[model samples]
Target: MSASSAKVRTITRIAMFAAVLAVCSQIAIPLPSGVPVTLQTFAVGLVGYALGAKRGPLAVLVWCAVGLVGAPVFSNFMGGPAVLFGKTGGFIYGFLPMALLCGLAAEKELPGRIFLSAAGLLLCHLCGVLQFSLLTGMDLLKSALLVSLPYLVKDLISMALAERFAAALRRIPAFAHTKC
Candidate 1:
């Protein structure tokens, strides 16, 4: 393909991943703390793995932009600036860095990718718990125990699934040629 065509294809793929992230965010389970467990992180990690460092965060940015603009694309069908700045907003904003970290790590070999993705997930949780605690006047340790701990296993599973999906995607000619 020509250079321009290749760029177009890459942009198209980024948009596709952003849409997928939005769709995955809809699969949310509400928690008593007003936070929701959504498949967003799974899609975020998958986008990073599939799109690499350059495009991954851009895709996440696109998703965030959509939600910020009242698209109802966030967890539990929430959206707009209110949701972005709400108690759970940290996790929403954290997705950007998470994608970057995961994509950068994904540039490495399999074991490295998994390890880095987990680290990225940890960062997301940290941001999430910190914000949750601050907004709710809860202690940090309590926030971690109540909000973050319960989701660790689930997020790990999502990370693993993302890795698997990325591996499969890597075999496709369109993705195989792209470099991180």
Candidate 2:
């Protein structure tokens, strides 16, 4: 394929991942703790594995930028700086680094991918808990127990599923040009 063709393909894939994150944000299951369960973690892991370090986080940035600009692309169709600066903002903020971490792991085998992805998830949770505590004036550990623990369990499974799906996606002809 020509270099331009590859560039276009890469841009298209990044755009698609951004859309995927937006759509995933809409698939939220609200919890009593005010943080909803969404497919975003799964999508984040998929973006990392499929696009690798450079491109994965780029896609996440695109999604974040759109959301911050008043697009109704966040959880519950919320958007704008209000959502970004809200109590759960740190979790959203953390997605960038999480994708980066996951992308770095994409160069490795499945076991390595899982390990790195787990570490990335931990970072994401840490951000969320920290923000939650700061915004709510709650203890960090209490915030984690109240919000992070439940979601962590679900996100762990989602990320593993994302890894498997990315592996399968890599084999498809359509994704032939996507970075590992």
Candidate 3:
């Protein structure tokens, strides 16, 4: 493919990934503290695997921007400037760098392998812990152990599954040109 065409493809992939993430945000598992756990991160990992570093973070940025415009794209259909400026805002805004850095770290093969997914998950945790500490005023170590560690195993599994799924998707005829 020509350079221009490749850039277009990358941009398209990022848009598609952002749309998928917005949809996934609706599938929320409510937490006791009013914050919910959602499958958005799973899509985040998938986008990173499918699009690699450059497009993956671009996708995340799109998602964030859409939500900021009162799109009701977040968990429980909550959105708008208030959604970002509220208490949960930090975590919401944090998704960009988390996905960006994680995708950058995992930017290796076409479909991210297990090791890359694990590393990406770890990066996500690090970003999350940082945000959690900054937002909640908790110590970094406490946030890491309490907030980051509990979700580590689950997020790892999700990342691995997302990577494997991307690998499978890339083999299909429809996605052949996109390279998934």
**Would you list the C-alpha lDDT of every candidate in the order shown?**
0.87, 0.89, 0.72
* lDDT (tens digit, per residue) of candidate 3 on 1-180: 799988877777789999998998899888654456778778888777777677787888888898988899888988798777664565565666556655654555445445555655666667666766777788989877776666777777777777677777777776656643
Best-performing candidate as measured by lDDT: 2
Clashing pairs in 3: none
| TM-score (C-alpha, index-matched) for candidate 1 | 0.94
Sort the candidates on TM-score, descending order: 2, 1, 3
Predicted structure with the largest TM-score when compared to the true one: 2
Compose the digit string of candidate 1's lDDT tens values, residues 1-180.
799998898889999999999999999888897877889889999998888888999999998899999998888888899988888988987888889888988887665566778788998899988898989999999999888899999998998898789889999886798675
**Would you give me the overall lDDT of model 3?**
0.72
Q: Model 3: runs farther than 4 Å from truth?
A: 1-9, 101-116
**Lowest lDDT 10-mer window, candidate 2?**
106-115
lDDT of each residue in 60-83, candidate 2, tens digit only: 999999999999989999999988
Q: TM per model?
A: 0.94, 0.95, 0.78
Arrange candidates by lDDT, descending: 2, 1, 3
Overall local distance difference test of candidate 1: 0.87
